[model samples]
Every structure is written in structure tokens, then in C-alpha cells.
Target chain A: MAKHDKDATFVGDSRISAKRIPNIAPSYSEFPGKSEPFWPNFLLKEWMVAAVCLVGYLLLTVSHPSPLTDKANPNDTSFVPLPDWYFLFLYQMLKYPWASGDWVVFGTIIFPGVAFTALVLAPWLDAGKDRRPKKRPVATGIMLLSLIGIFYLTWAANDEHSRLHPSNGGHSAGGATAPAAPAEKADSSFKPDAVWTAQTSCQGCHGVNMEGVAGPNLQKVGSKLDANQIADIIKNGKGGMPPGMFQGSDDDLKKLAEYMASLK
Target chain B: MLQKMYDWVDERLNITPMWRDLADHEVPEHVNPAHHFSAFVYCFGGLTFFITVIQILSGMFLTMYYVPDIINAYESVKYLQNEVAFGVIVRGMHHWGASLVIVMMFLHTLRVFFTGAYKKPRELNWVVGMLIFFVMLGLGFTGYLLPWDNTAYFATKVGLEIANSVPVIGPYAKALLTGGDIVGAQTLSRFFAIHVFFLPGALLGLLGAHFVMIRAQGISGPL
Candidate 1:
């Protein structure tokens, strides 16, 4: 006969009795404690997570690359600044203009700031003691959407092959990478805004295909340096290279590096 | 095979709670029944944990090719993306996830704060949570310079100058982080140790304490 009033607060007071709960019988009296018991459920779950992560990391670390690369070279201009795969989608997203003018910056930087601010303000927004998802729709909605966004974006970044599927015979404004080879002329179809977004620094020095008009041919460049070395050189700027002196940031390097790595 | 595959799909889709009945959902009469202890805490802790795990993975991967010295630090990152297979992916994940972690941790803190989840008996827990936030920022600050590239180099220099602006302790603090007046091998190693070893260890401890306090205090009151 227990019911929640208008405030949705329960009617009973003092001493929580699990027996009254339909899920657990009233006959149940004991609650699990830390020292008096076997492994706690939370502890077991935590350990399970830890174990899986350990295995995944170990496999990744001990592989052919050995998870360690060469030292930082300040002189390598061809280096790229790619970040981890999880961030690639956002990195990819930033290449696109969201609104006008500063959309890329807003999408990449300010959007994340808003999300963090919302997260920090979560405790206050949800003051009710209700522990049910159904009870807190806004918080619940934001949480679910955020998790989906994170997982989807990270997963999407992993699928490079997905990018190659032909959309139109020519290029579409859909992708960041140079469209399939047939789209060489399709690139010209891009709006003036897109063209004006950010000039490829590589084009300034290394020619379109890195044909060595300004620097050296990058077609065979992949053979010269490993992935890590290339990233360092691109980021650190070596020899005569001006070190991404323009449009340089963490995300910029990763995107540009991925582009250079794809050159081969 | 079809049935098994369906079951597999079901298992992954079973993230939503299906078993809790009406009474099982209840707390004390004074407590708000709407607050989901599982969802709130789980969302915060789970996201934070996942991000940390990402950092560890990406960070570990970076270490595979990274030289902890001033001279090699920059080249190492380059080597990872250029030569190593899928190294770009790993580095991208690490870099992005670091920013995401900082963002999520702050969000988790905000949830705790607005909920008044930090008051009274939980004030000490609140302090621990604050400590976790500070350490996360510390993680970002130190990790940013690891690339040893021009951006990292100059940004860090600006950063240390900001540090040195802290009146008397600024110079020493700057010295401690940069290993002299400038960034070099000592600076890289110092940042690496603080990032991988020192700060992470402290954060893990604080996180544990934060969780313990939550369980002890139950969910905070409704507004």
C-alpha cells in the first residue's frame, strides 16, 4: 500500500527495510560490508574492467612497434601531428566549418567547453534524490546522447576504408581527404568558402603531390622515416622547415600528418 | 548460430536496467525516489574511468616510440605516425582523449557540485574531488609539452612564464618543470614522470576516496 506523494518522496521514515521492497523479501536482514565479506560487487566489476584494459593495453604495447618510437627530431619538416584514433572524428569534424567564419574553432574548442561546463553543473541541475533514469530526463538524455556521440565518433575514426566508397563520380563536399583520384577536377567544385578555409601549408612548400617544387617529393617519403619520426618532424619543424608556423595546433598536426601518411 | 548471435546483441543492448521493480527503486521516505544512484554515479565514474583507460592506452602507445629526452621527444612522435603501423591512430586517440578526459572529469565534478553532493559529511569528499580535477589539469599541462614540437615548446614557454608570474614561487616552479630556464631533456622526463606516474597515482587514490564517500553518504538531497 506504499505510495509516492505529489513531491514523489516516499511516505515511510527511518530504517530502510529491503524486505518492504518487492524485489527483495522482508525476511532478508543482512547487508554486505567491506571487511566481513567476500569480494564486493563493485570491486569485482572494477577488477573485471581493469583486467580487460590490462590485456588490451598489453597486446597493443607489446606488438611489432613495441609501443615506443624514436627520439624527437627538431629538423624534420615532413613530420605530421596525428593524435590517437579516438580523437580522429573530432579532428576530422574540425576540418569542416560548422557555422560561419569561426565555426571550426567553435565546433572544436567552444563546443567542448560548453559540454564541460554542463558536466560540472550537473550536480546542481539534478538536485532531486531520485535515482531513476526515468526521473531525470534532461540529465538522462544528455548523458545518453553524449555517450553515443563519444563512442560513435571514436568508432567512426577507425574506419578509413569507409571513406573511399564513391559518393558521386566526381568529388562531393562530404569528405576531408582528397576525394578519390577521379575527383581531381571535382575539388574545383568546392564553394569559395571551403577553398578559403585553410590553405594547405604543404602546398606552399612541397607542391601538390609533394613533387618537390618547393621541397622534396613525398611519394617516396614514407620509405625514409617511420610514422613516429614523420610526426615529430612535421610538428617540431626541422632544418629549413618553418615548423607549421601557420594554422598549427594539436589537431592540425594529426590531420595534416594523416594526410601526409596517406601520400604514399 | 542465429539464436546465439541474437543473444549476443541482446547482451550488449542490456545496458539499461531491466530488473529493478517499484520497491527496489525506493530509498527512505525523506529521500527523493527519482535520483538514480546507479545512473548518476555510474555515468560520472564510468565515463571518467573510460577516458582514463583511453589516456593510458594512447599514452603507453606514444611511449613506444617517444624518446623522453629533449632531443628525441619531438622526433619520436613523428616516428610514431610516419613509420609505425596504425601509429597515427594511436597518437590521435591519446591526444584527443586527453582533452576529452579533462572535459569529462570537469563535468563529473559539476554534477557533484550542483547536486550538493559535496556538502557536510561529503565536504571532505568534495575536497578529494577538487584534488582529482586539479590533477587532471596537471595531467593536461604536463602532457601538452611532451610533443616537444614548436607549438609545445613555445606554448610551454608562455605557460611557464605564466607560472613564473605567481610571485615568489614562480621561478622555482618554472625551474622544476622546465629543468633550467628552458625546456630540454630534463623537462621532458620530468613532465613524463609527473604525467604517467605521479599525477595518475594520486588521481587514482582520490577517485577511490571519492567513490567510498559516495557509498557512505548515499545520494545527496533533492533541491
Candidate 2:
């Protein structure tokens, strides 16, 4: 193949502006001294990386299965919310004293908005042709600082979460945790009737085994509230518990209330 | 037989040149990992793409069992996890792959930035890649609410509240997202649509643009 002259003058057409086109660096325009076919060489390496990742992902899946907490309870206000690990940095940012209350938009919107915009416009923001990190002090410094900020914020978020709920175990960096098993203090001899089985939604706050979670301990609730009182609470909103949570008919609610009343 | 099949297709479709263009293209040594240890960083982008493919596949399988309504959503996910064959593995792949793809994409962005590969003519590609990154994040947000579990519920509630904290359009955005005063059946349905259809479609288009730009411009020169 004939080598093109590096400095060859190009004529511009009427439709296209010659000056508008950015000059391609020699490293990009000129053919490299050593090159290989993209097929077997580069693609082979890509496939290797992919294979390793897939295998590792499979191992992770089998070993630490994805967690499923109790079904969603819109009424459960006591449950603390934690975003996934990737969003922890942003979550942590919102907790900063300056970013809370009236100034939340700074952390919630402005900061993230500006950062994303800057990221998208990075190439134009740093328009120099110098590819070496050592030559681009400002760009390199910003990159390092941004990285440190993200890591630090994520760490702080995780630390705060663990501090708040030490018994739930520290937030898993992998974003997977074992299912939160209900406390094992329920009456084992209590047989679940049809009403109890149908009311799975109760488990969200009342606990899977009815030993209670965010809700008051219901293991022996029959010792206090009778079937009628329990039914009333289920119908009318009580402290922190939203009303009309029971989706069943009045008869079904009555049976569920009686069953709960019999728990003791 | 394979050779004959290839020749037959090449004769009719003129595929030989296309195959040659794809398979015989020269990769500059600077971008070739075999040539420089530093080029290993290039693998992050490809790995991110690989995980995205996994996510798409796993997500598709999940839809076979996933219900978008408030009533059946949790129950369906529970059924899929406990009953369906390989359900756990499939769900797990999508779960883990979501986080991994973000990590890989972030590392890829850092690599591109630090290497100064996003300069001049490559600026648009950087923008497209950034859009893809945001789409990936959007995918994560929408997918998080699908399980309808306690954590999903409260976490999404918090996320929406954060959106509601924005000025001017904040309350509107939250209303649009939640479809009402609260996160309910409509919210789940809307998020399901966005996660499975809208965002994925946008991601695919952006990815195509990103890849085409890379091919047209070729990989950036070594630092």
C-alpha cells in the first residue's frame, strides 16, 4: 500500500468547511508501525474477558442468591430506606448538613446536573490534543478529585447505614443480602388458617412468623386485644399503620382478626 | 460443507468483502492490549457491553414471570425465585449485572477521560457514551422498583422524594413518576414500561451510535 503524504493539501468543497474539521493527531491518522487483524487478536482478548466475567457472575449468583425482603408495605414508615450501592454516593451527598431541608436542591439536582453536563462536555472542555495524563494537570486533577469524592461519599453512606441499623448487618457492597428472616419467637403450635394464609401482606410489618418487625409484637396479641378490637385496628388507621390494609371482605377480616386474637 | 456454504453466500450476497472488512480490519498497536499492558484498560468498555447483553437476556426471561401490578408483582417474583427452573440464577444475573455494568461503565469513562481519548473529533462520541451511562442509571432506578419488596418500596419512595426536592419542576417530576399522590399500581406499571421498553430502546439506539462512532473514528491513540 502506498503511504499518503502527511502534509498533503486538501481542497475544500463548497458545502464543507475545511477549517471546521478538527485536525486528526498523527497517532490516529497515520497507520501504526505494528498492527494486527481485529478478528482473532483483539476480539479473542475481549471474549476472554467476557468469559471470565460471566463465570464469576454465575458463581456470585449461586453462592449469594438475590435477596427478597417481605412484600412491599406502603404503611411501614418505620422501615429505613437504603438505595443500591451505586447510588450510595449521591444518597450520602443529600445527608450533608448544607444540602438538607431548604437547600436540598443543591445536592438533589444542581450538583448532579452540573456534574453530568460537565462529563458529557469533557472533550470540548479540555480541547487540547495532549493525550498524556502528565501533560494535562487540570484534567487529571479533576478526575482524581471526583473519584476520591465518590469513594468517600459511598463509604460515608455505608457507615451511616450500619450505624443506624447495626442489627440489620452492614449494607452489602455487592448489593445482595440474605433475606431478612423474621425473628424466631412465634408460637410454633399456632396453625395458620385460611384467613392467615390469605393475609400474607401482614408479614411486611407484623413479621413473617408474626413475632413482629416494625409493628408491635403479635406473638401473644390475643392476650390483649380481642377479635373485635383487632378487626377495628385493621379497618381504621392506627399509629404508623395505615388503614384499610386488609384487602379481604368483612367476613374474611373478621376471621383474620379472630385468628390473630387466638395467637396467644 | 461450511466452506461451500460460505462460498455460496458470498457469491449471491457479495458477503466476502463485508466479512473481510469486519474480520481483517487492522487494529492499531496502541489500542491492542497484547502490545501494551496499559491497553488492558480498554477491556472495561467491552466488559460493560458484555454485562449489558447479560442484563437484557436475563431481564427478558424475568418478564416471562414478572407481574407489574401491585397485587401480583411481589407474589410473581417470589414464585419465579422459588419455583421456576434456573429462576434464581436468571434473577441473580440481572440483579448483579445491573450493579456490575455501572461499575464497568464508570471505569470505562475514567479510562477514556484519563487517557484523553475524548478529544476534538471524539467529543460527540463522549457525549453519546455519557447518555448511555445515564440510561444505564435510569435502567437501574426503574428496575429497582420491580420486585415490590419492602426495600424496593422504601428505597424507591426515598428516590422519588429526592426527585421531589428539585426546584420548579420537582413536584411535577415526582407526580409524573409516581402517577399520583403515592407510589401505587400506576407507578409500578409506569416504571415497568420504562425499564423494559422505553429505556432499553433508548439504550440500544445510543449504543449503536456509540459503536458506529468508535468504528468510524477508530480507537484513540495510546497515551
DockQ of each candidate relative to the true complex: 0.06, 0.44
Residues B1-223 of candidate 2: C-alpha lDDT, one tens digit per residue: 9978975554445565455555656778776677787887888999999999999999989999998999999999999999999999999898888989998999999889888989978999999998998899999999999999988999999999998888889999999889999899999999999999999999999999998898788888666
In order, what lDDT does every prediction score? 0.56, 0.82
Worst 10 residues of 2 chain B by lDDT: B9-18
Worst 10 residues of 1 chain B by lDDT: B21-30
TM-score of each: 0.46, 0.78
Best by DockQ: 2
Clashing pairs in 2: none
Q: For residues A1-264, could you state the per-residue lDDT of candidate 2 as single tens digits?
A: 998545333444223222222222223234556676677766887798789888998998898788888799876655678998889999999988787877888899888888878888888888888989999998899889999999999999988876655434447535554334444565656556667656766766665667655565577888889999999999985765778778888988888888889876
